[model samples]
Target: MKTLQIVFIALMTIFTLNAEATEYHVSVNGNDNNKGTAAEPFKTISAAAKIARAGDIITVHDGIYRERVNPIYGGANHLNRIVYQAAPGEKVTIKGSEIITNWKKEKGSVWKVVIPNSFFKAYNPYSDVLMGDWFNKKGMDHHTGEVFINGKSLYEKSNLNDVIESKPYEEALDQEASTHTWYSEVDANNTTIYANFQKFNPNKELVEINARESCFYPDQPGINYITVRGFTMNQAATQWSAPTAEQVGLIGTHWSKGWIIENNIVSNSKSVGITLGKDRSTGHNVWMYNPKKGGATHYNEVVFKALQIGWSKEIIGSHIVRNNVIFDCEQAGIVGSLGGIFSEISNNHIYDIWTKRIFRGAEIAGLKFHAPIDMLIKNNQIHNTGRGIWLDWMTQGTRVTGNLIYDNTTDDIHVEVNHGPYLVDNNIFLSELAIRDWSQGGAYAHNLIAGKIEVRHSTGRNTAYFLPHSTKVAGVSEIYCGDNRFFNNIFIKDENGEESEQEKENQSYGLHGYKIAKYANISSGNSYLNGAKPQEGETNFVEKTNLKPTIKITKKDHHVFLEMDLDPSIFNVSTSIITTELLGATFISEAVFENPDGTPYVLDTDFLGNERDKNKPSPGPFENLKKGLTLYNVGK
Candidate 1:
């Protein structure tokens, strides 16, 4: 009775503390000196953030906030998290850019603006060149500074003459928009920007220039349990967010934990959009500073060093990044290294990543992570990216499930240099190159794969793999290739699909790409259509070379649909529901494909969250997919 009374008293204390939590208000027509209330609000979000404590809420009204919100303190735990949100049914935009109207006319359609160097304070983005370990500048200079005219970003030219000429570049995605170019000349005293606005006058339009590095990011590490929601955050001068460097985004966590960044539109970053990455203390571009070792060697060294300095589930990760629309970023939409471990990234629409072909890099994707151990990447629609989901190194116990991935210039998924016990299930891959499997020990099940696969071995770089559902490194092993399980998947090839002659010749569809690998794959109960071949010594697969099903992706009114004609007899193959016990253990990591909490996963749900048959399951992502031409709403 005494123990029960003590527990009740503790619960009552928590309830009382939560009940007395403060709610601060911020508005554009307010003063910093005023008391933060609904009647008398704070002028800036930074003002309210300076005073907000645990379990407090900062409600920002509808306006354009042009300052970077650096929260002074973080909540103690998830239950008492400090939330920074836009007012309900309000349109709030937080930008890293400042409006500029002092543009003098130059020759032709070009204009020039000279700003004092004191305006940039400590960091001048125009002078800061994009350089990192894996970042390739394509033999051209690319600055983090950007020029926006009426909410549209202009392409950066290498020289001022290019802005004066105003000719469209041949390789640009938007050829006409390429003519709208900007060039910067940075001196010790001032920074001059020359831009070709075409017909639009920069002084008359809503012209803005990149002034800040990040819009909403904590300056320090250990700022945990913060939530940012319902804001349109954009136009940051984020740098090249390679894994070896400090990855600052438009709104980043900066090696923090329990940050919930959701229900916001993140766009127009010079590099990455959202970052859940490591700090510089662990190791920052050590390989770039001294090129004595390869990138893999430097990364492997950093992993052990991070472990020594407390890299675990309790300290880092467990972030929730969901329901966000991220786009127009030159690099990754969501990127992290070791700091993304045990995180959940779902229901996000990430696209247009690396769309600007001005630069190339080893790390360019919709979502890229180096050591995403025990992470959950589910139900996200990633399209029109360089690569869809790129998971490199130490991908143990990770699950990439129910994602609708398509139209990627590179492969839909690239798993590189990790002996994973990871799970890829119930996904729709409609790109030309579906899975680029450089690493091994993954379980691919119940997926609708409509493209070619590139399976190769990684013998040179020996990457680390962790214990099941944990960050502890069990062993380090080179990928000999193919300790993988491919079960109940549908591989389709468009024989009459729109392709150039060279593209058709280069296409090697389905599991045939795994033939040249050193190791062998465990393949069974898969359906191959239109010249997609099965693995060698596989007797349980189905082939339909004569049957041609019309398959294509359609987008209308911001909704994505998979228009496909599947025969009803496609479900004739006998397949069992996959489970952790049946998958057993991976060869290198000895980790079973399980949940983050080390529980066995039952693959009983389809891509649309429909219940699968327990006895004999269907061989694709959809359980009750109709016959003939059916338009399935895949974006939901």
Candidate 2:
């Protein structure tokens, strides 16, 4: 009788899967009236999305699609996913801009174009300045709208003089088209844009305006179990997505679960690129969370609302964002709020993330995530960015490992107010200010960190850790910025290293006030090379040094490079690698990453996806990552 029941369940599963599986096709030259078949493809992706069900597949052909795709439904699970793919080996470009060709010449290298108010019927990004909760405008108003000429995003100029005087080449960041500036004026009936093309003929080149709010975003929530693959989504006039607001991006998985966004080139946004964040909600009580009459309340209200709106393990985020080339944004390449729980972000190459130095905000980085409960960031190469990874509040059971990060304007990893049991390991951090810690209860091991290290504790600011496999918030108290461990790592300060960059400004590197918090942070068995100095007057660090380690160092293309060639038999870390005495918190030992519930989440994997020796793992990301391993260059 039990065997019969088992057979009945298997049959039911097969029947349900087969009932849901279907295929759809989309093309630029097709018609919306046609059925979404290979020979009779739909014209718009939105049309196919309206009819697609769970376990369906939508294959888009090679062409430029000039519309936004708002998917309403995600499939049930991984096996029953709603897959959206570019036709195999075909190029797909989805743009949020419309081609505007009716430009009349006004002055030298300046052109004027008038678009009717009715043209932007529902939305006009030009009228929307970058304003939101917790946003620092820097006393100037930057708009969400943008103008692009010949596939490059032009700068937004206030006046014709600002356009003529704009020197993009002299800009500090390596920008593609910053020299081309534009200005917009909106009246009751029409909107006008004055642009500087800088001697380029506007009649010959392709010019476009911000016609859509987002490139490939769903306006509604709970779009889950969707896989978007092999496309180039760009040129959106997206607004700022603070946690308090509805976090939208060029392509966002807003408040979704089990989504896989892979193998796409997502670029050219006024704000964020890809966002895995919460829906509109009242965020925690922090810097700007409250205003006199109209501001938000405290952290307990935020947590209570999360509970009210289903903050369980099944409802919140568990998305997979991997292998995508995301770049060229004023804000972040990727960002997430409470919706980044139980997620894996790996193998994505992110670069050139910040160009707006005139505006200052706490929400800009290559990747910025708030409340990353058990989130995994691995094997991703992030460079030429403003800051690499900013893991803010509620960062318990998080692991940042097996990744390559460098060429950032600020620190590679910056952890703010939290009582963490987080781990940082096996990373190549070649930045000027790597590992800027403001929180504590972290264990650092087997990393190659290069920069000034600093930590700060606060009495007013605080964060929370959680109970495992759940959102039952625990360890909720004032900020504890201590109980950290540093072991078996490499710190380099060659003349060819970070000191060269600091000396370019005649500035000094390394910790300036590190000895004050010596008891809070601990260290051991670390190697220092080329005058790389640790915090002076700190006697708590076990086996610390400042001289060159017994290793080879070389330079190629203005970057300092080094590797360990010692015998494997001689490579062993002490059993006192980590303990309750080292980290001022309780921990369970696992050969791999375990969740708060003692369930195995990840185990013994290197940056190259190679297995680490469970018994005696080597120091650093590569067990044997040699040959064509380019660390750095003049241009990345």
Which has the greatest TM-score? 1
Candidate 2: tens digits of C-alpha lDDT, residues 353-418: 876454557788898998888888877878877889999877777888777788788878888765
**Candidate 1, lDDT over the whole model:** 0.89
Which pairs of residues collide in model 1? none
Could you list the CA RMSD of all candidates, in the order they appear? 2.1, 4.9
lDDT per residue for candidate 1 within 1-636, as digits (tens), equals: 999999999788778769989999999999999899999999999999999988999999999999899988998788888999999999999999989888999988999999999999988899989888898888789999999999889988999887899788776677888889899999989999999999999989999999999999888988999999999999999988878777888999998899999999999999999999999887888889979989888988888888998999999999999999999999999999899999999999999887767888988999999999889999999999889999998888889999999989799999998788899999999888899888889999999999888777855998887767778887888888888999999998866544455543334666866766666778888999988878778888889877778878888988888998997576577799999988888887777878988789899999998999899888989888797899988994
Evaluated at residue 592, the lDDT of candidate 1 is 81
Give the lDDT of residue 91 in candidate 1: 97
lDDT of each: 0.89, 0.73
Q: In model 1, where do residues sit more than 4 Å from their true spots? A: 1-13, 496-507
